[model samples]
Target chain A: MSEVPNLDIIIKGCSKNDRESQKQLYKLYYSYAMSICLRYSRNYDDAVEVLNDAFMKVFSNIDKYDTARPFKAWLRVILINASIDHYKKNLKHNKNQELSETQGMTSDFRPDNEIRYEDLMRLVQKLSPVYRAVFNLYVIDGYKHKEIAEMLNINVSTSKANLTKAKANLRKMLKVYEDAAI
Target chain B: MQPYKDDIDQLFQEGLSSGNIPFDESAWIKMEKRLDAADTIAFAYWKLIYPLAVILVIVLAIWLWPGTSDNAESAPPVVTENIETHNNTDANPSSANNESSTTPEIGAKEKESYKQAPEEEDNAETDTTTLTESLGPSKISAENTDEPDVVRATVSENEATENSPSFTGGGEEYQSRFGGDLKILEGLDWMALDGYRGGEVEMTEVPMDTTREEVIKKSKLLFGLTVSNDWSAVGVSEFTNSGPSIGAIVEYLVLKRISVLAGASIGSRKYSAVGEEYWRPRWMDRSPGNEINTIAANCRVVDIPVNIYYHFAPKGLNQFSIGSGISSYLMLREDYAYTYNFADPNLPDTWVWENRNKHYFGVYNLSVVYRRQLSDKLYLGVEPYFKIPLTEIGIGEVDLYSFGTTVSLKFKK
Candidate 1:
């Protein structure tokens, strides 16, 4: 990881169209952007794709950047657009149906032990792209359901429904582990 | 009880830290390589093509168009006003009789002042007393049609010379013929001049001038009407996704090329989905009977945009403009968001509302506009501008930006 500069310095460098500056900027915000991507993505791959696209736009338009703003805030907007673009392109082909059915879903549980973070992550990864995205955005990334709905072109109700469902599913997964321990 | 929800957050945070995220090494490498090998040469080459072609075409056409400087110097101007009047009166035999028999006699001074054009001289002495009586009402228009290009009517005591009655003014014969105004009409050159001083100046009927420039300018103003279109992206700050937009414009000119623009494009910032699919409950499947459960309740204004703009453009055809100005915007809908939860699939699909702490503020814009001048006072223009936020429109550290195009019309002052 590179040492991140103050937002002023990054914006000044971006205005100069400096490549290293752009790369540095990307590194600083890549995690946040990627987190957002994962939420909207079907898998890690799709999230990464959205992240890359968002970075590309940031680079091309860096000269148009203003220095008075927080860098992460600006980066978030780009990531969101890129994610929306990615979603629009890949939405039809997504196999969301498989992840929608809650019936007969099996959960892995740890007996007589505290649950591992890694194991939780594995379960998150196992979630359908749509569910994972909503869960991450609402719970982890702190995005509002309305925003998610607009970005995803769905109704506000859908976003709310998904958040509730995502949380419930996660709770269920965690319940299995508790039951196993018992 | 297992602390499922509490542990899940930590688990996800851990997952985020690990090397779980995928990277496209080759794609990034190729993209970087392409960026490194910039195509400056291709761009440079294309730049020269337009100017050269324009210069060549202009030069060749000027060479072929007939030069008329010498002929213009010697050619007699076609008489306009005075000649037209003389010809009108001469063509009517009834007018000739009226001139001879009018009851009202001309004043001696007036009779001596009127002079007939050379063409009308034969009937000059035919008791012009009657013509003098008819002069008051017809004089206003008569100046436009009178025949003689220039007639010097000097009242001379030369007796009613051809044995015909002549209106005498102060013991002199009066002549009534004169031609066009040389000095006034001389300035009506090939350029776009102001309204009529010599001929008709009515807006309802523009005079017939068939030159290319005149036709183009007139048509531009005649069809002049304004039109404007703009769109704004919501929930985006540094990088905004322009959302659905609304705007209004008006075009008013002879050529219909000039326009006045006032519109607001919703440009908060751009955004992306976490992926092709956002998060959702595993139980809500939207098939035959489960349709209600498939309903999606959206999040709140985590990021929303409100944009306002005012633009001006001159003349141009499609995708072109000839003038430039500013595109001002005000960002209203910040990144605040609300959420709605849905009922379980086993139950019916119902919505539950929730709100989040999202905020937005600040303003940003692009000032470049593409202007095309289609006429003297008309234009069509487009601005494919981008807005980069100076600060987060919201309280978060998320960056915001947006890209979009706007069309405008410019009018002559």
Candidate 2:
């Protein structure tokens, strides 16, 4: 219980940029916060970058420690926000490449058209960056479509539409695999 | 909502399949050092006060408990006095009558009555013996005037005969022992009988039914199987969709409702949901690393159940059990699949690749079981069992090795 109070004191000491205190704070949350960052990053090295960047923010804003909420929970929010910022920067850069719009067959889809589980996963992984992000946030992360639109700076309908396309593409790939296996 | 089912399920599972990324070894060591440097006074106080409080309470209780005993000392004297008075009164009744003239004390009414009964019996016995001797010559009545009515007649004749001394005093002076006059108390002899009495023991025997009519029972287990649209159970829903699974159970009939059964069960569950990704400038190789990619789902779980054809139901078989207990299946192991997808088939074999498997044992359950008899040898059962794995897998050190529920049918002979 008192670890929280001690953590506050430690943060205060780090804000002074005391070399030992700074090292102590860095070492305390580096591994765990980095793991969280890794879950949201492109690779291991990006996770470490996000971790270092989030900790610098934590040190600068040590005065905001409320002494009420858990230190870990607060640290998690900061790390998540940092990872999001990093993701958006990459998203903007990738959008520079012109994408050729492909037309769908525009037919009602049947779910029972047997599909192998493996091929479906490959097709999902093949989705464009924006669609995959929207699909993951909305479907896997349990975020509402509205939250997805707000987070990605896109309209709710766009998020919904992308998810539908992602599923459709996966189903088509799965159908081909299931047929070949038969 | 339409089950919210999507390809994202597949992606999540694929990501988990990538395998547990081991923690950086240096990170744990640094964490320990940081914690050690932090001082925690409140924790120290709590540790000190708890044991101190417990010791004080124990000391207070021992000091305050009652310490002395007065009743144990006063008992023996009362018993000694009662024995001495009881013996003297029985031995000298006439001497006691003369001593009363000297002491002028006849104590209690009951004690005086007890003394009078023994003296009266002695007097009566002497008179009867004299009458029998004198009456022997009474037939010569007229000649009996010499046998005066003031007759000490039989008494006087015996007195002359008793004046003759009998042979006395032979050998050694020995102290009397062995048959000494020790009085036995009431109820003292029952201790041996009490020692032999049996203590409480509950022995129950399940009797066999006279009628050999058979009764059948049944049971089942079911495991939900998940398949990533991506071919795994580890990552995002955008990546995985589970396949269909089906299960059922049955048992046979024996005496006293005991049944033996054999049944097989099968099912699958998907794990791994795809997650958001970021690029590390340091690790950027192919161009500026400017694209967002999904973390592929990694680990998934699938259950394949085995059938033990002659397994008897676990209950009621004990009613007429010839042996110790219920005989049932001893589960060997859950089947596992260590599957990997070549993210880049063209890459060399040694290229860094995402590793994951459906072989994780850490999901919700590991053991397969049958419920009680639904009919005869037929039983319905479910076990949400778990196994602590012997090896490590996935992003964590422990691989969730085997998991699933069983819906089975058991057949008996």
Could you tell me every candidate's TM-score relative to the true structure? Answer: 0.43, 0.26
Cα error, candidate 2, residue A47 (Å): 3.0
Model 1 lDDT tens row, B1-413: 43544655656655554543434455456546655665343246745544554454344334322233332332222222221222334443333321111122222222232343333455643323212211110111221113223221111122224444432221122234112211112212111122112222112222223442343343322121222222333334322234423233333232223333333333223343221122343223322233221222222222222333332221112233232223433434333221223322122122222222233344455445565543333444566755565554332223344556654444332
Query: Using lDDT as the measure, which candidate wins?
Result: 1
- State the TM-score for model 1: 0.43
Candidate 1's C-alpha runs over 4 A off are A1-14, A27-32, A64-69, A95-122, A125-129, A173-182, B1-3, B6-27, B30-180, B183-195, B198-221, B224-413
lDDT of 1 by residue, A34-91 (tens): 6667656655666666777777767666654444334465566567667667766766
Model 2 alpha-carbon drift over 4 Å, by segment: A2-9, A19-24, A97-128, A139-142, A165-182, B1-413
Q: Give the per-residue lDDT of model 2 (tens digit) for B283-323.
A: 11222323223332222223332222223222221111111
Docking class of 1: incorrect
